[model samples]
Target: GLIGKQPSAEMERKYSNETQVTPQTPPAFIFTCQDDRAVHPDNSIRYYQALMRNGVPSQLHIYPKGGHGYGKRFTFPYTEQLQYLLTDFLNEQLSK
Candidate 1:
């Protein structure tokens, strides 16, 4: 495991992005697949929730398939959609 087999409380606290989320945090674009085995979709969901709670601008996209680490892979079902969404987010941010 990336965090070691048994991560202690201090390690968890130190590595937790959600816990560090605050109103001042920058906007985010988050996406994940429901079938991702390496990282649970709930992690994205929870982080998005935290961003929303803090009134931070954010976008979240959860596809049904595509597993994990599918970035820019032509075979991934939602590759085009992901690219479009990411581009749109970046454009919107830049225009702000």
Candidate 2:
């Protein structure tokens, strides 16, 4: 039988809470948007800082303005910025 799965409220809440807890340390790139309203950008900022403090190779970009769901549908100065960030991260990771 094909089973349809939907996230239970408990699961959803757990995931949401987990997002708030920054990783102890991250060894790779971390990307975050400053103007993101849905998820406070501070979480990413703190995580990136933690990575930096631990001597991990990481970078973060905080756009002046780019609301949530900016995905590829919107065009703003940050769009180009995010593109370059992604490209750079890929190159760095693949080179290793």
Candidate 3:
């Protein structure tokens, strides 16, 4: 719907990050919640798949419950797990 509302082709192209993904794209840490209402988890899954197809290093974590925008929120059920995953990803990246 938003794509149809774009004023011009340039505006659409400017936000189409997926089409721009390539081997040169930086490594990614993709995290999403399956039940998020704000943004669909499939977007993350597709991005991770794209990164992998291009041979880029990436990690994808899809938790079952947390809705959306739960970053650093202690009350989120997966807060500790998210922290561990993110920290481990950063450490692994830094070692490279």
C-alpha lDDT values of all predictions: 0.89, 0.63, 0.83
Tens digits of per-residue lDDT for model 3, 1-96: 345654687865665556678999999998889998877788788788889899999999999988888885767898778789989999999999
Residue lDDT tens for model 2, 1-96: 011257777665555423434444434555556777677777667666666666667777766676766776666656776778888887986787
Q: How well does candidate 3 score on lDDT at residue 83?
A: 83
Separate clash counts for every candidate: 0, 0, 0
How would the candidate models be sorted by TM-score, starting from the highest? 1, 3, 2
lDDT of 1 by residue, 29-89 (tens): 9999999988888888888999999999999999999898888577999887888999999
Off by over 4 Å in 1: none
lDDT score of residue 71 within candidate 3: 85
Give the best candidate by lDDT: 1
Candidate 3 segments exceeding 4 Å error = 1-14
**What shift in Å separates residue 13 of candidate 3 from its native position after superposition?**
5.9
Ranking by lDDT: 1, 3, 2
- Give candidate 2 misplaced runs (Cα > 4 Å): 1-27
By how many angstroms RMSD does model 3 differ from the true structure? 2.6
My TM-score estimates for the predictions, one after another, are 0.89, 0.59, 0.81
